[model samples]
Target: MYCYVSEVKLVSLPPILCVHLKRFRNDDGFTKKLYDKVTFPETFSTAIFAAGQSENADCLKADEHYSLYAVVVHMGSTMSGHYTAFISSNQDWYYADDSCVQPSTWEKVQGTYGGYRQRSGETAYLLLYRKKSWNSSG
Candidate 1:
């Protein structure tokens, strides 16, 4: 009989959190990229991951939250790809692809969630979130 236990906890929270998604994998000596739709919320709560005695545990108990502010999107396969970014500024959204920048919408941002097929247009590679102020209304 074998028993395995895994434990993880957060010791502290930072003002800014960056999340990287694993979109590539090596199989049988071949590197391939995966196009999978991963849904993320505009606002995320970290309270569930807080350790009991972690720094600022009180903030977690009080429902401290983070808001998504930016996303890095990757297009193409593992061999080569192009990168773009969707950024939120003062409640406005913009898409930046190389030297081109244009105003965008939340709907457009959501489109980067990727698809369930190989070579699917764009996929979110990185996500950036900022901790909401304690006094923030939302």
Candidate 2:
């Protein structure tokens, strides 16, 4: 007997959902590459997920309420690719990223998304578009 399963079919049917991503632009020649997280307190409980396929995002669960977070690596204006984040209030479809937000408090927004939440001295960021529904098994 042979058994096989594709990674594409995984994390597709998340319990929660997110929203579509927004686009950003850069006028400089240098592309800023970066990574960050949106921490969730240990007391916090929720199971959230993204629309699978993206590299940075996930679903958080606490009791019955779920909050979805999109983790993005912004490459600034110099780079090119899909730079966005999806958020959701529905509980039908969702997505998830391999990485988890740490510190459990700070809602990490990437550079691609452009935010002042980053460190007092750090620059550049990324994004993971959240979604409320998806068909892919990412």
Which candidate number maximizes lDDT? Answer: 1
TM-score for all models, in order of appearance = 0.84, 0.24
Q: Write the per-residue lDDT of candidate 1 for residues 43-108, one digit (tens) a residue.
A: 767655654555644434436788889999998888898999999987788999999999999888
User: For every candidate structure, what is the RMSD over all alpha carbons to the true structure, in angstroms?
Assistant: 3.2, 15.4
Candidate 2's C-alpha runs over 4 A off are: 1-14, 25-64, 78-138
Write model 2 residue lDDT over 1-138, tens digit each, in one string: 999976532334345333323333343854443433333221112233333334453333212332344443333343554332222223222222334322321233322233455443222232223333233322
Q: Whole-model Cα lDDT per candidate?
A: 0.81, 0.33
Model 1, which residues run further than 4 Å from truth? 50-62, 117-120
User: lDDT (0-100) at residue 99 of candidate 2?
Assistant: 48
CA shift at 90, candidate 2, in angstroms?
22
